[model samples]
Target: MSITLTQLRAFLAVVHSGSVTAAADELIVTQSSVSAAVSGLARELGTPLLERDGRGVRPTPAGAAFAPFATDVIGLLEQGRRAAVESAENASRTLRIAAVTTSAESFVPRLMQAFATAHPGVGLTLDVGNRDRVMGLVLAHQADVAFAGRPPRDARLEARALHPNEHVLITAPDDELAARAEVAPHELAARTWLLREPGSGTRSVNEDFLAATGLAPRTLTVGSNGAIRQAARARLGVSFVSRDAVADDLATGLLAAIAVTSAPAPRAWHVLCSGVGPVRPVVATFLDFITARGG
Candidate 1:
């Protein structure tokens, strides 16, 4: 029997949601329907695709390997549908945008507003995620454009610098370090630091800053920008975050920047588009706006 899209979707949903029951809930289908689809898919592939893990489900090695293929198939088909719709209905043009959390909170809104003002007919769909999720959306052809603090490394993608991104060490306004005129790097080593989780672009930059300054601090991993900002405000620890992300806090005396002898040079926020082909009309229009803005 041929593998059908229904089976593919069911299998992928189960793989993502980690349970047949959860997948059924998400897909609005019966549990038996999801189970049968996945089972049929496994049989057609001649291997077990999933195994139980704790109270949920987990993809086996084979299932894990097949996920990208499944995502690409779904993403490409969806892209085709959108393309056909856009062609037949010019007034319904939509641009799917994905952005890392920091940029989403900081600069993406202004850019989107300006773009919308310029092209009232085009619709925008913005997805906020961490770097990995944003990059995956772009790579899968699910996003027409993506904004990230750092450029993606995939050669299949093209990237452009949209704006500057500056990171700084921040502390509670009343912290002793905040009063110092020029704090030495060694002084920070013994203090606590609020760090982003692994695989975050912010975490990578923070690590680099620590290594470059030749200091190590006791670290606490905080998962989100808002939480980290609150932790800093509560005087729990210092943190390295984008100036853009903490601009209002800094301006209102909620957080203070430490004056250091050597600080990280400014990086950039990048606009990324995946795939190596002539640009689509909507994407090209956005890129042209980006160029004009950046220039």
Candidate 2:
């Protein structure tokens, strides 16, 4: 006979609780039911799954080996249930969004708050990652929509320009670079440059800026905007990042933006969705809100 989910669950509970009585209590069932379920599972697998130790229970080698797989199966089932519930609730009034780090850090929270206020009872999930990863999430249908500085060229996704985004050279307030209201691109290039990972939009813009001016710097690559910011704050090196990401720091004088003549003009931020068909209603509503608010 095939292994039953019920039996697996009972076995896992017993392993977790370390005693059949405790497992029964946790499962809100009788101890006999737990014992019978475990025994049945062991018989089906043709192996001894548990052993009594003094006053408690312990998994035998076979049971211990099966525990992880059983837990994973149960987890997947729970996740499937959650996804179904989320999908149904989404059909009624929920929005699932994925965004690159900058957009998520700077705009998403406010957008979510406003969206929630405007559409009460609407559920929302926002996943944040780098540009490529966020786009992938949207393309895979894991997210209904995404926001990023530039839309990807993937054929499976549809993208629309939302608003212009500016990148600024930032440095710690105490750093010598902070004294300059604006540093020429070539001069800026001479400094140690902290940068985001290669695929990030900010990094792309930074590279473009260097290429346009025919300048390269001592470069140190970091993975996230937060890391870039921290590195800059530690006075390790200057970094260029989205203005939105550093707005608060710029305002507070903890960090300063170094103007550069050759800096790329602000580029358009885009909203991306799957190319399959008409956008979902919740995603549409959010896109409308972002466009209306001038992003």
lDDT of each: 0.87, 0.80
Could you list the CA RMSD of all candidates, in the order they appear?
3.2, 10.2
The local distance difference test score of model 2 is 0.80
lDDT of 1 by residue, 95-159 (tens): 99999899999888999999999999999999998888888888778799999888767775789
When summed lDDT is taken over every stretch of 10 residues in candidate 2, the lowest stretch is 75-84
> What TM value does model 1 have?
0.82
How well does each candidate superpose onto the true structure, as a TM-score?
0.82, 0.66
**Candidate 2 lDDT over residue span 37-100, tens digit each:** 9999999999999999889999999988887667656655654554566567444556778989
Clashes in model 1: which pairs? none
Backbone clashes per model, in order? 0, 0
